[model samples]
Target: MAIDLRDPDESYVSFWRERHMCTLTTIRPDGTPHVVAVGVTFDPEGGPKGIARVITNKHSRKVANVLAAGPEGARVAVCQVDAGRWATLEGRAVIRTEPEAVADAVARYADRYGRTPTPNPDRVVIEITLTRAMGRA
Candidate 1:
């Protein structure tokens, strides 16, 4: 069953606020999953109600995959595991290159990770509008 996280519970919110790593899965043009360890943040105030953002270089494969998926956005999934507790977020992701979007992503990242990431000319943010969330936690 899918959990709607637009109004997530305290436990769900807590899980995201705590420092934890997540694995992002994006689909390649050939229908394969390109999974990678990524630093992500849950922005309850950004994008739609339940948005998850990941920062990456414009040249990254995940960026390419999201862009290649076109205007409708790409199907993406992010999963985080901590011992017996785990959560998976399934959503539609879009690559945002606008300055404001990048700034917001960076700010959220800093808030979550406690450090500002070094600025890169090729930096971009992948904004995911979550549709389904599920897991033990």
Candidate 2:
């Protein structure tokens, strides 16, 4: 069944937000998909439409892949799964180092993971503006 992504409820948002780990996939310039285990931060507002934040070392392969993909970066897909449940979110990765963006990312990380992300000059924040969601049981 196909469902409209615009209608994600708070429950759905909270479900994903509470998940401890998620996989983030990005496309390399050559078209190979690189997926990595990552800690994720769901937007405080919560919902299908809110953006998700992820932090990474600026020199990491994921960041390298994003940079190699150019300013628009590659399409990003994030997934959270448990024994009998799963949720995936898809969106374009927005790479930036702006102060506001940095602060937002830091805040999300601290709130969700309870660990402050150390600032790495090489760190780049990826904001996944969710465009879709799907679940399986």
Candidate 3:
């Protein structure tokens, strides 16, 4: 079910904090979805609204898909599940290649996943400024 983005439930918020693999769905140039498993992290300091982030290789197809769409960004959805509970965050995503942005995403990923990812010089961050959230948390 769709949930209010502003008045998010504490349980729902906690669910996102839980460690779980999420599937990021990015649109292909032909309008097909290209979904892949990824470790996602949420940042609550972005603005009035927090954003979800996924760090990946700069040359990854997902990053390519987002770039192929347009400068505004590509529509994307990230979903996670565990047994009977599941949740999804959907929004427009853009590729962030700045060193600071990539480093910040890597740091957040480490904090959430317990270990820093293998250092990759080609790292890039897909920043999703959340527009909607839904789940049965």
Q: Best candidate per TM-score, number?
A: 3
Supply every candidate's count of residue pairs whose N, Cα or C atoms clash at under 3 angstroms. 0, 1, 0
TM-score of each prediction:
0.94, 0.85, 0.95
Please give the lDDT score at residue 33 for candidate 2.
92
* lDDT of candidate 3 over 12-131, digit per residue (tens): 888888889999999999988899999998665465566999999999999999999899999999999999999998888999999999999999898888999898999999999988
In model 1, the runs with Cα more than 4 Å from the true position are: none
Rank candidates by TM-score, best first: 3, 1, 2
Flag clash pairs in model 2: 58-122
Give the alpha carbon lDDT tens digit for every residue of 1-137 in model 1: 35657676778778887789899999999999999999889865555568999999999999999999999999999989999888888899999999999998999999988889998989999999988888776
In TM-score terms, candidate 3 sits at 0.95
lDDT of 2 at 115: 79
Candidate 1 lDDT at 112 equals 89
In model 3, the runs with Cα more than 4 Å from the true position are: none
Prediction 1 TM-score vs. true: 0.94
